[model samples]
Target chain A: AQSVSQHNHHVILSEAASLELGCNYSYGGTVNLFWYVQYPGQHLQLLLKYFSGDPLVKGIKGFEAEFIKSKFSFNLRKPSVQWSDTAEYFCAVNAYDYKLSFGAGTTVTVRA
Target chain B: DVKVTQSSRYLVKRTGEKVFLECVQDMDHENMFWYRQDPGLGLRLIYFSYDVKMKEKGDIPEGYSVSREKKERFSLILESASTNQTSMYLCASSSRTGPNSPLHFGNGTRLTVT
Candidate 1:
């Protein structure tokens, strides 16, 4: 079974601080990676996705993720984060089928 | 925009009661998924349907069953609700366009079993 692991459980940072959340998946075959974010009361929305070609994929709201096949990692990054970036971030992987395996998720709190 | 609509935003049920969480999609997507989200568990897939009348169990489908009579709707059912089943249930739909297609999610149904 394929599983996703997110190293950071919770992160607290001041506004304008850089953010990087580590994500690793346990799949060796062709995989699709995604970063989804959930606001306080909003549904989960796609922040970015990596299907093929480019390893560095840019997403909405200044979010980006790099898919490193060698490392089996697709980490989410942002040069600077705002208070609005405070949300729960999830890393998901699809290896064989339409089913997506998600990591435990990282709670990000950006303070102003 | 693709829309996945869950019927309820909040639900409270007693133990041993049968509970149903409804989800409908407007994008004519061929795939619909049911997931339960906890504080640290992220989203665990409970069940998924690829087409009408075709359902498959996901990683954690022990206490749940699903119904997909129509292509646009998928339903998750808890035969006997328990306290452990209390969590935020999310419904998502995605087209079978390709592997890169992201899921469109409903706002979610927060269920509490007493």
Candidate 2:
């Protein structure tokens, strides 16, 4: 079974600080990676996705993720985060199946 | 914009009572999914439907059932609600165009079983 592992359970950072949330998946085959964000009192929304081509994918809200096949990792990164970026971030992986397996999620709290 | 709407934002059900969590998608998506989100457990897939009236059991489908009579609607049913089943239920719909398509999520229905 394919499973996703997010290294950070909870992260706190000051405004304008660089951020990185580690994500690793267990699938050995071709996998599609995604970063989804759930803002306060809002539904979960897709930030970005990587299917093919570029391993480094840029997403909305100044977020980006690098997909490293050798490491089985798709780590989310932001050069500078804002207070508004506080939310629960989830890393999900789809291995060409109809279902997606998600990580335990990382709660990012950006302090201003 | 793609929207997936759950029937309820919060639900309270008694043990041994049958519970239904409804989901509707407006994008005419071919895939509808039911997931339970719990602390420390993330999102666990309960069931999914790829087409109308067609369903597939996901990772955690033991105590849950699903109905999909229409293309835009997928319903999750709990034959007998249990306290262990108390969690936020999220409904999502996606296109079956290989893997690039992301899942559009509903606001989620938080169910509490007593």
Q: Looking at model 1, give its docking quality level.
A: high
Model 1 TM-score on a 0 to 1 scale:
0.98
Each prediction's total of clashing residue pairs, residues at least 3 apart in sequence or on different chains, is 0, 0
Residues B8-110 of candidate 1: C-alpha lDDT, one tens digit per residue: 9999999999999999999999999999999888999999999999999998899899999999999999999999999999999999988678999999999
Clashing pairs in 2: none
Candidate 1: segments with Cα more than 4 A from true spot: none
Give the alpha carbon lDDT tens digit for every residue of A75-106 in model 1. Answer: 99999999999999999999778899999999
Once fitted onto the true fold, the runs of candidate 2 whose alpha carbons sit more than 4 angstroms away are none
TM-score of chain B in each prediction: 0.99, 0.98
Cα deviation of A92, candidate 2, in Å: 0.6
Report the error of model 2 at residue A20, Å.
Answer: 0.1
